[model samples]
Target: MTRAPNEDAIWVALVDDYDVVVKGVATMLDPYRDRVLVAELDTDRPVKDDVDIALYDSFAQPESDQEQIKVLLANPRARKVVVYTWNFHPELVEAARALGTHGYLSKALPARDLVAALEAVHAGEIVFSDPPSRMRTPTSQDWPGRQEGLTDREAEILALITQGKNNADICEVTYLAPNTVKSYVRNLYRKIEVDSRTQAVVWGVRHGFLPDHHRIDHWRGGP
Candidate 1:
């Protein structure tokens, strides 16, 4: 049966290729079970159960302008789709809006604020978090290289590199300046103790940098 928002908690599905990323968000929202119930955590599979929102996490995945947004929006099970991302470039935001996304939220938002935003979106309001002044590492979230002293941004860059994205590709996808992308690459290389791209890719392969290529079925429990 299709579920609708009522007096109960808003049902949300966390979408991302990395289990750690979506699980982090789920854990952040766990305390707010009365206001938000994370009904699904979709790694690569389509969300099965009907949900009020599909929170698309942009960790190691394509930005908002890509086809994934359309895929999420097309799923009838997801009543709304929201881009949960750190990149809030104007073009990216506009593109998502043009594509009919219900919201574009920043990763910097605290768990409480995130829940509030989700509630607002569920109430039929098109919401967008103010462009963050700076991309501070969200302490509550998790990424691939967090254990090795790599910040979320650094870990994202390394994941892209592992996926065979060059510096130019990185800049295009991340909306970062050429020099900035180079700097991130260098920093991640240093943190991972690799001196070259090939070495970094090898290390990334060994240490969970590659994305989980398949969707997780029966996540938490079978739908």
Candidate 2:
């Protein structure tokens, strides 16, 4: 299904601090200069500004993984982000879905596959499945396994934080002391790679399954 390169160029932001990866990808994609714009970004890049697509390494911890994803998805210009990695984790895919990722593929995949994945996502299909590898199937049964790898419980606590819950309400609901909850929320923001409830809400809506300010989950009679 290799069609003519759609008339518009796809702007891609390569968000990695490593020089070799950035340089290698850039060199590999040199032929498509007119079609691809590659910029190696760290935290310093204004993530919310502009981008059309992204190729990132999300084969890591949920905390770090989501952090990198937020940087790309937050961009108004970015419509899709394809995570390139050697090892694909099931939980990472789940988080990416919540975060609105376009798709992800293996770094070991052929170069043609990578380009095809990029084009596929850019063309409006969000490919979320990872082929069988060392990773286990992404069943709901794997939920506990997914949550277990967190560097801290604070981030897990943040997952339960609804938009309307205040510090006092959270203390009562979570059964944590008020000061502890506040500290946890602060740390959670740093952990899940978001700043405010709004960002977290957006993050949840895109990659995780959660209700928005509209409280649609409540309306659905969900617990």
Candidate 3:
């Protein structure tokens, strides 16, 4: 049965760089409007609205050094920050926790579950299902580029490139200078034997790094 929204709804802000994705998520939460009062809709900007939680969706975005999370956490308007993305890699989860994310949700979650997670997080609970702890096992499966001779950071950058993020986008998320990003791109091309972004993306998709997983197939344990 559908539970009625709480009388004291949690104020939320959906933050992302894509308007369509942000607005789409907002629409999905519309049914639970009574439970989650979406107070702000922003695209990669400092959240100005006072909200209980800031949901940052890494939709079509590259994996970075959790810089954006820091930005969100620094903003006084948002009391807590949650990452809603398809990057279920174990390293990303550790990064999120290290950055102090209240919750880390996979994009595959249904709206109902997402709502419940938001409610729990607002109620002072940490929620996470992606990257099950076991996946963190010291094995090759944990690293996407282990066989391909790419460092974790390189693989991360390559993953972003596969998502069609340009140098500026990667730099912004990874907190790297433009020139440094260019260097990474050059190194990735050399390591992956791809001369251009197109070739690199092709390699990435074939290597299971581009299309983020929907479920935690490599998880080890824990919530």
Each candidate structure's TM-score, on Cα atoms with residue i matched to residue i, is: 0.89, 0.49, 0.57
lDDT (Cα, tens digit) per residue for candidate 1, span 14-128: 8777878877888889888889988655454544678889888888766433677777787677789999998988888899999999999999998899999999999999999
Arranged by TM-score, best first: 1, 3, 2
Q: Between 1 and 3, whose lDDT is larger?
A: 1
C-alpha root-mean-square deviation, candidate 2: 14.3
Error of 1 at 202 (Å): 0.8
The sequence of per-residue lDDT tens digits that candidate 3 reaches over residues 1-223 is: 1223564988887765544345667777888888897754432333334678988776445453376677777777678889986556666788889888999986667778889999999999999866443222112112466577775457668878878888888876666689878887898789889888888989987886654332111111211
**Cα TM-score of candidate 3:** 0.57
The best candidate by lDDT is: 1
lDDT of 2 at 177: 78
- Against the reference, the lDDT scores of all candidates come to 0.82, 0.53, 0.68
In model 1, what is the error at residue 14, expressed in angstroms?
Answer: 0.4
Candidate 3 at 165: error in angstroms? 5.9
